[model samples]
Target: MSFISVNPESDFSIHNLPYGIFSTQANPKPRPGVAIGDYILDLSQVSKLFVGPLMRNEAEEVFNQTTLNKLMSLSYEAWHEARQTIQRLLSKHEGVLRDNSELRSTAFVLQRDATMHLPAQIGDYTDFFSSLEHAINGVKLFVDGDKALFPNWKYSPLGYHGRASSIVVSGSPIRRPNGQMRPIDDRPPVFGPCKLMDFEIEMAFFIGNTPNKNGDIVPIDEAHKHIFGMVLMNDWSARDIQKWEWIPLGPFLSKNLGTTISPWVVTMEALEPFKVVNVVQEPKPFPYLYHADNYNFNVNIAAAIKPDNGEASVVARTNLSHLYWTMKQMLAHHTITGCNLNAGDLMATGTISGPTPDSYGSMLELSWNGTKPLTLSDGSERKFLHDGDEVIFTAHSERDGCRVGFGECRGKLIPALAL
Candidate 1:
């Protein structure tokens, strides 16, 4: 892996490289780009870079248009092939994109002139609660102590369907939602605005393809074959509204307001250099969910809040290694009953908090179920997000003197509609 000319400290710099869709204001047509220095090398314009067994005459077709939808539709092997090609083209080798002044203008553009779009045309989105620390803290609020953890937690991945339509690309505005929320002392539930809006710092996996059989679940050993990459996700919540309506079903209005995903989809191959072990589990998983080798990989994950008008405060920083279950286990368990997972489908690790207070991934945990108050820099106490507040989630891989990061997941809160 040759070193490319990139900023020493930029989040999108070489050590922190990733892929996404973007284009200038002059050309709104979305195209694939790999982050280098402060600019996005426009792959759509430099189509010749894609060649070889991936495609012969049509090798350049992947970059002909904007949005990774066409490329994302390819098989997992194609995804890896394309990633490797792009990585090489962006590498320190001077012949490709580096020293060629003639191709520089056509190949590179300042990132500021462009807007980042959703990297994939998501087919489906599923969220899994796989963090042991986050689960324990949350469960303790309701159950408390070792009893806080459910007996079956170590056996399977807990998951639920999420709204794909509401999953926004980074930098979009998120409006507060009108829903039912009841004060702890209220007589009954009140039909009004949400007071406890929240941000869930999480990491989600991108599925590249499905199993051979339709409706068949991905097996544990082969789950990585279907995985494309990873991104930071914020499953925004309306905690007060959730409290009132979460009776029989898990989440409805509270969890659906607006979810944000990082623009870059850092490929799994890019993360291979930093794979770490998964969190330790007291009771080993059942046969179907167990893997002989690695159960999960390590990626340093984190979340921070930059008030709409203030400086950034690192509210939480944790690791993907804290996950109780491996992505393979989750995918295998998800499909053991015969559910299908398609290419571009998303699976998330819910609220990836560590064992300490600084790593509390969500306001619900930080505020301790609304009983305690979170003090901010400006002397403001937050039980939940106030209008105009912003939340951001970021992830990266840094070790052995290298770094790779997901840009950011940012959204501002707007006043709830009067409806």
Candidate 2:
């Protein structure tokens, strides 16, 4: 139990001390912090207490860094030990931090007064289409119904390199991009505001530990040690632009506009209690991608939409367990070709739609390529997002009356700038 009283339903309980970067008005520089109830434990002010054997040497540097990359580059043993130290310090039963009044005042800051920043300085980003249902639903709309799944899809994880420069922390505005799209068959392409803007509900994991060399391939069994934690993600899309440019090469302007991620990174250790059986893979993946134990977590993800000055309407609900390719498999496949991965690199699970229509993760699938319109609770309809529409994505795992969650990934769509 923590010395601080936390609501039973709050995501920042003693069991879930997720980390982030924040800056208060009084202290304008971003620093490392841990979430506890309604307050933020400023690691910058309490770095001295991390005197455990694993972190005594580097506590100050790790906690004082503006971004999490420095801490993430440390050894896995260090990461594990740091979490243990933090848990003990916050424990109500016994600990120096819980009993010391002066230290507590300096280390704890109210959440409302702090501005959250991107937890890590992402060097690169990759988006993976790991959900089987999402692929099938999307393929059926763009390709022949009988040939939904591509032949190469089941063999390996499919992904594309994405723009790291466009990733923004939650609460940032996503300006609708102006791009080229053909309105009719045999018509000239016109450049204007994106007409088919959409939001993709997804989850992304951060890389920790030292990076591999250009030729080193990380095995599947050792992949978990390299993963630091997860955050909710919303990959904004322009459907019309994607259709025109995705013939020989993959996404370009259609996806590079913007992507949003939650500030806090919920550690994998905190979500261990919610682990569920992995989805059954057909034809059995190659030996390199196989893992005997289940790697799937039963995290419930949902999306909501709020129009200009209107009440929020729940749009979709899905789960991470619905993913066909496990995270370990994706990591192993990523390096099999001798590619290197660096600390703070992000890998995302592209739109995680489940088996049912109501569980679809994007408007393109929920509305069936604009053939139908999604009806909201307030007697409103939407086939594609409009300017001033805010999309919010949230995720959590509940077990034994404890809920650990990635707070929220939210962004509002603003009008595109004039050409």
Candidate 3:
């Protein structure tokens, strides 16, 4: 409905004006931009268009920054007002931007000519095991038959602190990590390149400018205000190394090697219409982690693998609704002990899996720990990722011909350095 010529099937529709940091060849300085159709609406050039009460004077300064941290630190009301002002300015009926020839030339840049960077400087990252099916699969594959699920898993959301410095924007090359692994049961661990490299399909949210005091907990009802938006993530795993090291302690080098994330961050307001019922929790969590409103989004998440010379083929598909714990619950539980959260912090839903084999989220679950291999269109079989394999993660929700999507989170695995 806008003045732009957006294809109906394009993910960057007027309804989904996702934000990211980008730069062009002429001006190499990174700046904030909003994706629309095939072009990026340069916020730096059109900052004055945000004339809403909340963003009137602040927009020009915030949009000029190289990173999104300052903008994300604003109040939730200010964020909402920014979106409203943008939607109005881009509307077909609005002559302010639609008819301004000089402004249009400066305010819009073709997406293909732009280079993307990380939206914010993430201070910390947390990865949560919130999917019931993925957890059950792990228990079945690795634990004794008597313990179907970990006792603490049902009581609360389980998570681990992740390395923020290693997290990279999509399309970055992932170097296979070298670490010690006990390949044989009784043999001493050997140090070498990872043999079982894998990918984990996930989605993460960036914390807003709102920060809690060190000794105060963010209530479940108020967690939404602290969340800014979501992005697709690929938590690359070194399975053999992880199994050897993760015992009393959780993931370390096996997880920190490199995590890939999509460039654009799809805001909560754009995805509001896709909210669906959450997975039912059996024992029911504590009162502090409960919320009457539905926070689970009905996003269709899928993973595909492409060999260096072959076509991409989808291997797994799942929905965000399958996650047993909501983002609100995760945030509430995270700060229950009075741990603080900052504006650019990230929290991810780990390996979202559903009830079927094809819905599994990671290579460990999809191939049943290498017992069953997946055959691709080129007749190549994969139990784990190869040196030239590229893993791609995508997520989107569509209704009534309208789609809100996080574009591809992609990474190509390369050989590790010689030990």
Candidate 4:
């Protein structure tokens, strides 16, 4: 496909074809749009003014909805159909959308003036510690490298239920949370603002196609059938709070603050060409849990931190392939307990740090349990995220000679006010 005008740097390039909800800042009503040439082609507006024969014939109801959820709930074939339709409409060919001047006036909106909104109405969220390297590193920091991995990790995907209500759109600032922490020297837990705020470098899988019948819980092998797409995710954390509260039941106050997701949802169909085996196992998965392609995609992920006022500092570079458990494994494990998943639900890959000091995903690990500090390029030191720290996560796949990038997932930190 010929590259369209939305500069290559723009997240919505032809290779990207990411979907999101948008509207002009003046009107901010939250409607569907496709990024094209420094502009957002408003699907809602295009649905009304578009006189194109093919699009008019096949434009599904998803385009009419305010968010991408309607489109996402459709089947993979349906998604492909919509993508093809949108691509053609966006093409620079003479007989394409440009054929109608009035249509262009109504459909095209500048991206800068556009207000980006949540891509979907997330119903529920589940976080999984799917990265072996990350889990080992975390263990090594608290325990040691020899027993870096714990029980129930090598066997299946270890995960925890997360808060959906707290998830936020990109650019929204996160607040430093009030949490309970313990002092080292024979002191009881004290209440104060979290001192070790951090961001988890990860990716999120979006669920779609809810099972309708009595046997509604989807099997592991068929999990992909119900998924919509993937997004770059930053699962923010408060290490100080987690340490105090996490004696028995996992994360609570530390995780509930705010999680951020990239504005665009990269469709599952776009990634179909590059599916590989999830894990190399001698003991294959059980029959019911196994389908066909049980492999993971080679999606490259990275994290960066920038002061609210200054340039970004590169943090970690990792990939989904490094994950011990794949999305399929996580889904299989989720439904192994017969849990029913709904449309718009999210399954996240937990903290994705690699095995090294420089590859640490969070400051807690890089600082070695707060023993050291990270020296930034600007000569600043960071033991933990401060009041004005901003973190960004980006995920992309370079396959078939195409670099498909999912726009940055970002959040700013604001200090907690005394209550």
Candidate 5:
């Protein structure tokens, strides 16, 4: 236990020291940090204390960097070593930090006074359609008749390369996209602000330091070692634009507008307690995507919407365990074709919707293609997000008095720029 008091339910307990980047008033430069209780423990200040065998070689330079990419480039054994060292320093009986008033004052920053930044310098981002429920719901709404799942849907994880440049930290305002959309009868597309603004509740994992040659495949059995951690994500969507341009390729301007993610990256080491049996794959997956062991997580994710002047109302509740394709399968499939992934590269599980309606992970699904309207606590009904509406996402996995959480993925819709 840490000397500092942490609420039993607090997301940043000593058991879960998620990594992030933060800047305090005293030092405005963003540097690596770890959340504990309600304080941000500046990893830069404690860099010298990382004398463990696994971290000794890299610790000196890892924390001084502005982004976490350098740290992320370290091996899993190194990451585990760093976590173990941190836990010991913060433990109740440890005199390393708690006993030293000057060191403690210089190292810990109050969470409220700190500003968080993107934890990694994401080079490439990929989004995968992994949830069976979400995929089925999307097909039901978009496909014309009895046809729902595509023939290849059951065989492998389907994914698309996304724009990494548009990914932003939580709290960044999302500008409503301006694009071309057609009318009810498929008239000529008109260019203007998007009418069908929506958010997809997702969870993304950061890649680790495993070096794979450009032409080498990352084996299914070894994918976990290449995965660093997970974070909550909101993949903002312009449904109308997606509908119009998705015939040939896939999502274009409809998705690249803005994607928000929580600051902290909850390491797989911290999430091991919440592991669950992965959703069963039907029709048997291809040999390339097959993994015998379960890679599913049991994180509880909840999302809410708040109008400009209204109270926030919970919109959806879901779990990552609902995904039909495990993240390891996605990673394995990604590299099966010899596509190399670098450290800090992001991979997202697209819209994790559960079996029930309340477990829907996106407004597009919850509103059912605008046929259903969701009522907020402010007596406002919404089919899709309006300007000034804020969407918030949060997640945690708890068992036996231990809880690990990704703080919040929040973004407000700002009106499109005058065009």
Candidate 6:
């Protein structure tokens, strides 16, 4: 619908104006931008055109920033206004931008010439075990059916605090972590490079601009207002290290090595059309965690692995709807104890796996704890990732011929440092 041509299959269509921070060699300063077809609408160049009352005065300042934190810290109304203004400016009938040849040249940059950066300066991060199939798979691999489903899991969304310092934008290189692990049951633990490096395919959301008071709880109905948007994520893991250290505590160094996320943050407004019925929750949740509306999305998620010299092969496919705990429920439970949340905080749905082997989200589950090896397109077999292996995650939702997507969340594994 825009003056510019957009391919029907392109992830960034007229329907999806995802936001991110980007830079180019000509203008090395990172600034906010929106993805559109094969080009990026440099928000900094078009900031003055945001004439809406809510964004008219503030657009220039926020769009010129190096990170999205300031913009994300705005109210829900402001976010909506900004999106509406952008959509209008890009409309085919909007002569302001479509007819301005000089403005168009400076405002649009080819995507290939721009470098993407983290959308926001994340202050905190949490990863939740929200997928029923993934949880069951873990139980089957490590423990017996007697402890098939942990009793506390059904009551609330269980999660662990994660390190935010190591979180990286997509395309970063992840060096294998070195840690202690008990390789043999009868032998003492040894410290060295990880033997079971894996990737957890996940989808994460950024908290909106408002911050909750330390003693206040976020009601389930209001959780959506506190969420800004979603992105694809790869929570790289060193399974051997995690198994040895996650006894009394959960995920330490094994999880902190590196986490990668897609650059573009697909807004909730763009995904509204893809909303589907929430998964049935037996033993109805407490009032604080219950919501009548559907928060589950039908986003299709998939992960693939590519060797340095080989073609990529998809190893797993799943849907965000597989999550047992909805994002709203997770947020409501997160603040039930009065824990404060700030703008740009991140929360992720952990390992979204479906009920079949092909739908598993992690290498750990896909290979059944390394007992089964997966053969790649080049006939190379992998029980776990090798030094040159690259993990790529993609997610999208489509309905009525419109598609909204999170571009590739990718990372390559490199050799660990020598002790």
Over the stretch 297-413, how does candidate 6's per-residue lDDT look in tens digits? 999998999999888999999999999999999999999999999989999999899999999999999999888999999999999999999999988888878988888999999
lDDT (tens digit, per residue) of candidate 1 on 1-419? 43545654566755445778896788878888878777887877667767758644454776775666666667678777776676777777646666777888778888888899998888788889988888888777644555747777777899889899899998899999988877764487788888888899888888765454565767788888877778899999888788777667888888887889989887777778777766666677777888877746667776767776887666677888878888888788878988877667888988888788877889888888778877777777777788988887777777776777787888888898888
Worst 10 residues of 2 by lDDT: 139-148
RMSD of each: 2.2, 1.0, 0.9, 2.8, 1.0, 0.9
Q: State each model's CA lDDT, in order.
A: 0.78, 0.91, 0.93, 0.76, 0.92, 0.93
In order of listing, the candidates' clash counts read 6, 0, 1, 6, 0, 1
lDDT of 3 by residue, 326-394 (tens): 999999999999999988899999989999999999999999999999998899999999999999888
Candidate 5 lDDT: 0.92
**Deviating ranges (above 4 Å) for candidate 6:** none
The digit string of per-residue lDDT tens for model 2 on 60-147 reads: 9999999999989888889889999889889997668787899889899989989999999999999999999889987787666778
lDDT of 5 by residue, 89-206 (tens): 9999999999999999999999999999999999999999988888888888776647768878898899989999999999999999999987564578888999999999999999
- How many clashing pairs does model 3 include? 1
Worst 10 residues of 1 by lDDT: 1-10
Higher lDDT: candidate 1 or 3? 3
Model 5 regions more than 4 Å off: none
As a TM-score, model 2 comes out at 0.98
Model 4: residue 237 alpha-carbon error in angstroms: 0.5
